[model samples]
Target chain A: SQTIHQWPATLVQPVGSPLSLECTVEGTSNPNLYWYRQAAGRGLQLLFYSVGIGQISSEVPQNLSASRPQDRQFILSSKKLLLSDSGFYLCAWRAAASYEQYFGPGTRLTVT
Target chain B: AQSVAQPEDQVNVAEGNPLTVKCTYSVSGNPYLFWYVQYPNRGLQFLLKYITGDNLVKGSYGFEAEFNKSQTSFHLKKPSALVSDSALYFCAVRDIRGAGAGKSTFGDGTTLTVKP
Candidate 1:
């Protein structure tokens, strides 16, 4: 079975600080990876998606960026965090043959 | 562009009663609709999907949804509601027309509150 893992399940950071959230999927290769952010009581906003290594598509141009450094590893990063950047960040992966996406536990970011 | 609409922001249902969370969509081509459930402070979980065939699709935890092509709706339904079913439900749609076609557009999400 495939499993998605995300680190620093919860984080508290001050404004202008750097941000890094990691997501890794085991048991799958060449999967489509996505990054999404959900504000309180709002729908999910797709931030980035990657089809392959070194390929990233940004849905909404913002301070955040995503990278697929390895086939199974995806990272969401930001040089400087904004107060609006505070939200629940979720990472998801879908197999090339499947339409359904599997999500990780998610990282709750609070930028104070 | 593809989009999904969950008309109701929240739904209230009593335990043991039938429950329904409405969802409608708009897409340029054939659509792949899906339903996902999110518990408080948790990631979204895939509940069911309607790709083709069988308008009625059954999924985890005794949840089901019906796809109505004419209505452009895929409403999530459950015959018997449970208190545990209280959570946020999201509707998503994907248009099968281009590269990276599986990327989904999600609705604002409907909060299902099954009262005891």
Candidate 2:
């Protein structure tokens, strides 16, 4: 079975501070990875998606960016955090031939 | 562009009654629709998907969804509501031809409250 992991489960960052959230998938290779943010437990806003290593497509322009450094490792980063950047960040992966996506536990970010 | 609409912002249902969460979509070509459930502060859980074949599809935890092509709707349904079923529900749609690298368009989400 495949498992996805993200950390730290919760984060608190100061304004203008750097941010880094990691996501790694076990037991899958060359899967499609995605980054999304949910505000106040509402709808999911897609931020970025990567189909392969070094290939990332951003959906909406914002303070955050995503990278696929390895086949199973994806990272979401920001040079500086903003108060609006605070939300629950989710990482998901889907198989090349599959329609459904599997998600990680997610990281709750609070920028103060 | 693909879009999804969940008309109800919130739904209140008593336990043991049947439940339905409505979802309608618009997209070019065939649509790949999905239903997900999210508990408080947790990641979305994939409940079911409708790709093709049967209009009725069953999913985890006694959840099912029907795909109506003419109505352009995919409504999530359950035979019996449970108190544990209280959570947020989301409907998503993506064009079938968008298989390469397309992202799914998700609805604003509907909050389902199952009271005892």
Per-residue alpha-carbon lDDT of model 1 for A1-112, expressed as tens digits?
9999998899999999999999999999999999999999569999999999999999998999899999999999999999999999999999989989999999999999
lDDT of 1 by residue, B6-52 (tens): 99999999999999999999998999999999998889999999999
**What docking grade applies to model 1?**
high
lDDT against the true structure, per candidate, is 0.94, 0.94
DockQ of each: 0.84, 0.88
Candidate 2: tens digits of C-alpha lDDT, residues B1-116: 78999999999999999999999999978999999999998899999999999999999999999999999999999999999999999999989875423689899999999999
Stretches of candidate 2 exceeding 4 Å from the true structure:
B98-101
C-alpha RMSD over true interface residues, model 2: 0.6
Q: Compare the candidates by DockQ and give the number of the best one.
A: 2
